[model samples]
Target chain A: MADAKERKILVAVDDGLESLYALSWSLHNLVSQTSNDTIILIYAKPPRTVNTSPDGYLFSPDMMASVDKCRNDLASSIIEKAKKICREQGDKEVKVEVIIESGDPRDVICQAADKIHADVLVMGSHGYGLIKRAFLGSVSNHCAQNVKCPVLIVKKPKSSSSATGTK
Target chain B: MADAKERKILVAVDDGLESLYALSWSLHNLVSQTSNDTIILIYAKPPRTVNTSPDGYLFSPDMMASVDKCRNDLASSIIEKAKKICREQGDKEVKVEVIIESGDPRDVICQAADKIHADVLVMGSHGYGLIKRAFLGSVSNHCAQNVKCPVLIVKKPKSSSSATGTK
Candidate 1:
């Protein structure tokens, strides 16, 4: 029934405290216990490097293999951490799906949200001050600009005594 | 009585379509019909200028009064528009309040949210890309970092079909 249908929420995740806090906030504030909500977790990685070797240098498959393995391991751990948080939240009706894409996050997040027809796209801000963000750029801001759905960029409360912090 | 508590939601509104859509989204998606939700609408205006005249002239009291009246009228219209939206939506339990503040938004917003002990602070993002935001800065971004509560920045969706129209 349409009244009982699940609301799909796409949340961008990384292995950071802010992202974890966002996930926590969603579980308590946004996610409904009986609504069978679907939460899509996405983590974006850089594209594979196949660039030409430096001058007088040759490509090394052995080194490349190790680098690939390291990257894969990190991705696995990060996804696992997110999965564990979802489980701990104990929302029996909520469904969580993990996706790891190779590309810039600014592009991947918007595309994924569009493909999923997400009700809302959630993320956590890095909270970089004015000067720092100018140089590094903000993925949440980019997703907000390009995505076709609503974007929620959660920031951790600045004080320990904040209402959000108590929860 | 405690269970039917009023949730303080501070929404920063402007003349932009994005901000209007944000107000719409909140009424539909965030505000609970069953609970008593208090919506605080804040409009930030530039501080009244008593600066030295550009042509090295003196300040005129009559000119200043007229300028202040113009600003006040503008603020009244914007707040009335927001209130009309709420009334049209017909959520009887929700209470709407209006506030007009002067000086820098980056500072005023965070301070107001803190003083209100707001449960959540909502606003609309202009969605400037990385380079533009770096040089120009963002009021919502700054409030997200400094406020003690969670911040929700709603961006106008890219497609015309979405509730929020593109620039």
Candidate 2:
């Protein structure tokens, strides 16, 4: 028997398609539609965006405003995308909440999960190899070690295995 | 409705308590005891043991044999422990398998999961912070990035939240 209270699942989302894949996977496999679960979709922007340029010069007020607006818009769009996926389920009893923060994703995600007391944290792997270590990636590694609750890192399914699990 | 075929779940376990906690968590949350699923428990030993002297100087052939025997014995003991956990479910239809490999755990785990075509890979997080980085840890991070299938890095339930999710 399932509990009456809602299960809070915090899913970390970004611009990558893998994030959406993780979203759909958790929606279908992990979330029990019969239960009143709350899906908290989170998006974290970099803290430096609000302050200065890459060269350490103080950002102009106009530039700062534009960057902030751009980040906010991106967060809203992704959260809307997640909302549309939830709507497809047609589970009217379920609730969805969106929270956008500005910080390093590795630390921000773990802090958000703890602050919200999330039941579980779900993430997506970017599949970067050793060569790509210089670029942005590896947050999942840090989050897995730091998050207090259970964390599920969903892989982007290959073409052949993509539609197989949905059925 | 659950599938009729068996689900191959490769769980990466170790001598740590987090591993058994992950084992029991999967048994309760992920494993469909009703389904004819196969659980493969895997443990990776370090590539080789360390010694102060040359390859064949300090570690004589007999001493090397004894060390290898001890490591194999530990692996067997852990496998037996995993089997006992499976037996507690009393799911006669469900099968349990054990594998022990010697290599870097990060690379070995992902390779094993792929070789077996595992439906899902389960891992336990030791929650080791930077201070403890000198020791072996963080294999789950690498496995999540490389493993083809979905990876569940289960966090050991905190004392206050341990009994909260059973329902």
Candidate 3:
């Protein structure tokens, strides 16, 4: 029965401790040790701007290539750290998949969830205040509203609740 | 050890299939059979309005009592149905608690979650569009941002993704 329905749980992670905390929570809470569930770890890198130069300064070809490599390296490191967390916290039998895409994190996460038909999408809340969240729209909020599957927004305990302002 | 920490999971339910679907999903995906997890089912009934007259017509004392009784009955029925679902879907060992409160759902849910220090808050998305959601704020969305704990917003499969409009 466990093998019959393999749930694909997509976890969006980043450098923030909040996202990593979410991944850990998912491992301990959602993924069953004996079940044939697949954990998909995704990191959305900032989109590369190899062609466009900020402040009208044209980038050399080598500079552009180096910048791209730097982003790729960061993405790989994040994924590796997430994988380690899964191995330590989750069952060994659970399959883990990795995805590194270059785009807005919100778009990348929602697209991947829909494309993979993920049973659930797990993410971390940035815990931004009303003014900040209004200025810099929350990625988790966007995905929660947009994603087809269930979206789990994990808030780190230390972060203050955003609703305090309303009260 | 599963016994070391028994998570308190708060699930807010209503008459809609969306909330019930969320409860079912939580039982299957979050609760471990062997763990001594407590599932708290909460239903927030619309606040009593016995004193308010809508059309300048005072409600008689008996009429107001009947109205209050009717709301109470509805709340009891909803809670009973939710309890039955928990018994059917969750493991027998898992503890179940029920709460029926009268107030704005957003406030009732957030306060209960905070008061109990729930490990996770589960809710169902109403699938309201932008205009509708704006006109009538989404309780789940409000709770997700306001609740201190992790929030799991389950979207019924048939409900169209709200992200499609922006796409």
Candidate 4:
């Protein structure tokens, strides 16, 4: 079945350079792998906390609307930027689906992949140092362990030090 | 350098079924990718602790000898098993080098890759769950983030129950 062609490839994106590399790589490679492949660009939105009263109810309709508007705006901006990159790479013909879900980053990515029956999950590794990683383990690592499909973690090219040097 | 025939591909062994799959896949794919690629089997030996006085000085030369023996035994056993796997796969011509180093797994693996100028690093994703991962992230993640070369993380195919039922 290796040659059957993966129909769906999921690209999990965070505000990271490596994730962008993964997106670019997916735009280039997925088309070669399968014409029917769909690129699902997923962004995990962090949940907003609303202070609750003793009655255990929180957030009025107006406040909820404002929060929803902010979320939609953020999601749309990310999607637009990703689309621009895809266009620049000249893979506009490849189907791209932008998905924004609220929850833990790793959980949302894995759940979305399963829900979409993704054959491959493409992502970038935010290579944190040993101390940082020991305290706050990376999301990419968590997803790789939990996801069902193969995870292609595109590393930031060494020469592209300008992009990944800070993180 | 992309087309340069990979002379050596290092596979880290950690006594996991997923690792076996990764090893098998690497053997098949790397050999197909290049005609004369070698497989280097590396096993990282954990550090040994010598008995120390209350003031944190070494106990004695005999204690140091015991620690060295323990490290050697651990490394040799893993190397022996890896060599056996290579032989069973009929890769005598591939020139396997079984290396053993006493240090962190990620550090040792990266050092081995650099020392040999390995073209690729291959390992398996153990599919640890959220709680376990939160406690201790997998080694595959650490290697992927820290290593300079390309890393291929092969995920274990999920059982039907977990695949179909869980998020």
Listed in order, each prediction's TM-score against the native is 0.78, 0.76, 0.87, 0.60
| Stretches of candidate 4 exceeding 4 Å from the true structure | A1-4, A25-36, A51-67, A87-94, A127-137, A155-167, B1-10, B24-104, B114-120, B126-138, B158-167
* Model 3, position B51: C-alpha lDDT score: 79
By lDDT, the best candidate is: 3
lDDT of 3 by residue, B104-153 (tens): 78899999999998888998888233455576599888998899888999
The lowest-lDDT stretch of 10 consecutive residues in candidate 3 chain B is: B158-167
Estimate, for each residue in B1-167, the C-alpha lDDT of model 2 and write its tens digit. 14354678788877766776676666655655334567899988767656535655677777877888888888888778777776774324357888889987787888999999887788777623344434655777768778888888877766633312243
Provide the fnat value for model 2, as a fraction from 0 to 1: 0.48
The interface root-mean-square deviations, each candidate in sequence, come to 5.0, 4.4, 2.6, 7.0
Q: Where in model 3 is the C-alpha error above 4 Å?
A: A1-5, A91-93, A127-136, A159-167, B1-5, B91-93, B127-136, B159-167
lDDT of 1 by residue, B1-167 (tens): 11254678888877666777777777766665444678899887767766457897865878777888888898789888888876765335468988789866676788889898887788887622345447648766677667877677776664544433212
lDDT of candidate 4 over A1-167, digit per residue (tens): 12233367688876666677667755643343213556788998766655464598886888788888987787778777776666666333666888888876777888998888886687877733345446647777777777877677767776774322111
Q: What is the TM-score of chain A alone in each candidate?
A: 0.83, 0.82, 0.84, 0.74
How many angstroms is residue A29 displaced in model 1 relative to the true structure, after the best TM-score fit?
1.7
User: 1 or 2: which has the higher TM-score?
Assistant: 1
Clashing residue pairs for model 1: none
- lDDT, model 3: 0.78
Q: Mind giving the per-residue lDDT tens digits that candidate 1 earns over A1-167?
A: 11244667888877566676777667655664334578888887656756346674655888777778887887788788777777776335468998889877777888999898888788888623345447648877777667877777777655533213224
DockQ of candidates 1 onward, in order? 0.24, 0.33, 0.44, 0.20
DockQ of 3: 0.44
Clash-forming residue pairs, model 2: none
TM-score of chain B of each: 0.84, 0.83, 0.85, 0.70
Report the C-alpha lDDT of model 3 over A1-167, residue by residue, as the tens digit: 12235789899988777788888878777776545688999988877645668678788888888988898888888889888887776634568999888887888999999999998999888832345457659989899989999999987767543211110
Where does candidate 1 stray beyond 4 Å? A1-6, A33-36, A50-63, A90-92, A127-136, A158-166, B1-6, B33-36, B50-60, B90-92, B127-136, B158-167
